[model samples]
Target: MSDKQESIKQAAIALFAKRGFDGTTVPLVAEEASVGAGTIYRYFENKEVLLNVIMQGEMLRLEQSFKENFPYDRSIREQFSHLFIGLIRFSQENFESIMLINSHTTSRHLSDQTKCDYTSLLTFLSTIVEAGREQEVIDRDLPIEAIVAITFGAVVELAKCFNGGELTLTEDLLETLDEKLWRAIST
Candidate 1:
């Protein structure tokens, strides 16, 4: 959490997002961060370690965003809307983080703990769907895993489109996307 470490993390996120995990190099990240290549080693044990650090940091940020904005007292529909809006907002503001996460999750170097952490977000979403099912608000015909996969997949794809410049992340667009996703899972 020192300035040097943070700089390396930020640079890594951008590079990892643009060039991918395997495509990016430690020296390139060090140069982008304006630090000696050795400085990176001071913070991270190796390239894989640095990548994991960035992934874990982004995942934590995502979880914090959801926890801060989740509407626990609202109707299921409203809660879903809030969650969708939060995701879009997070992706818009932290494009590199989202891309870094997407890249890291697929990397073979990721540790089992990191993989579990990655799925933790999906598990949280499954719980929400489960709650809706209990309330007869969400379709109970599909398994919880399938429901979560479909919902999270749609959001991730839309975010990817925005990141790739195929679409813009606008308030109007988010509202429309939220409604569409809600209808897909709603009973």
Candidate 2:
């Protein structure tokens, strides 16, 4: 993408994160990006298209961050710790993308392919939970999806709290959260 295109995407993400998809407008994004309204059309065919593009890009970024930080050969506890910390770090570094992604999960404009891509990240996390079950580290009675939901749901809420200034993302707090999350699922 060109610099202008990237700028437009960034501006759109900030606007969408703040105003929501339905509330945001192309002219607002263009104004924020310091580009002409027609320039946005050159890059994105329409507002929905722009939102989808931002969502897909952010999803890919999140997926890549998890894959890069995941400790494939480590113990379940260690892997979970890495994953949780990586999530917090990703949220801190890409607050706009995180908010944009959190906002767009239910959007009607997102393509089926984009939804599948997003689902794959959940599946990847589920595999980690499955590993815990296989190793007898996590509760074997609970379904894998439930385990994943509980674990991921907790972390996501914490991230949201941190993003909203309700909680601080201190290192000590992250470690405490990691331990608490592990204890929640572990046998």
Candidate 3:
């Protein structure tokens, strides 16, 4: 993509992350991007299309963060640590992306393809939880979806707090939070 297009995506991600899709306007995105509103139209047919593109791209990036150097041969505990740390690091680096992703997940503007993309990310996490359950390392009484939701919900809330300046994020804090989260799910 050209510089202007990339700028538009970045601006839209920030605005959508902060104001939400319905609260944000195309003119606001153009202003943030330092481009004409018509330029965004040139790239995306409409706001919904823009949101879909951004959501899909952000989902792929998040999934990639989880998959990078994943410990396929490690114990479930170690795998869980890897996933937790990966998410923390990703949120630290892409705060706006995470906020946008978490907030707009259920937006009415999302396309079917965007929904499918989000589901694939969840499926990846569920696969890990399933392995843990088979090994008797995860709580079997709780469903996979519940486990994921609980863990992810905690992390997302923590990220929101950090984003809001309510908490100071550090390596030690991240490790502690990771252990706490792991214990919450591990058997």
Candidate maximizing TM-score: 3
Q: TM-score order of candidates, best first?
A: 3, 2, 1
Best by lDDT: 3
Model 3 C-alpha lDDT per residue in residues 69-121, reported as the tens digit of each score:
99999999998899888887788789999889989999999999999999999
TM-score of each: 0.89, 0.91, 0.96
- Arrange candidates, best lDDT first: 3, 2, 1
The digit string of per-residue lDDT tens for model 1 on 1-187 reads 7999999999999999889987899999999999999999998999989888778879989988987957898998998887778877788788778767766677898877778888897778778888999999999998998876686567677787887899977778888888888888889
* lDDT assessment of candidate 1: 0.85
Worst 10 residues of 1 by lDDT: 148-157
Error of 1 at 89 (Å): 0.4
lDDT of 2 by residue, 1-187 (tens): 7999999999999999889998999999999999999999999999998988888889889889988957888898898888888878888888878778877887888888788888987888888888889989989988987887686567667778988899988889989988988888889
Q: Which should have the higher TM-score, number 1 or number 2?
A: 2
Error of 2 at 130 (Å): 1.3
* Global lDDT of model 3: 0.92
After superposing candidate 3 on the true structure, give the runs of residues whose Cα lies further than 4 Å from its correct spot: none
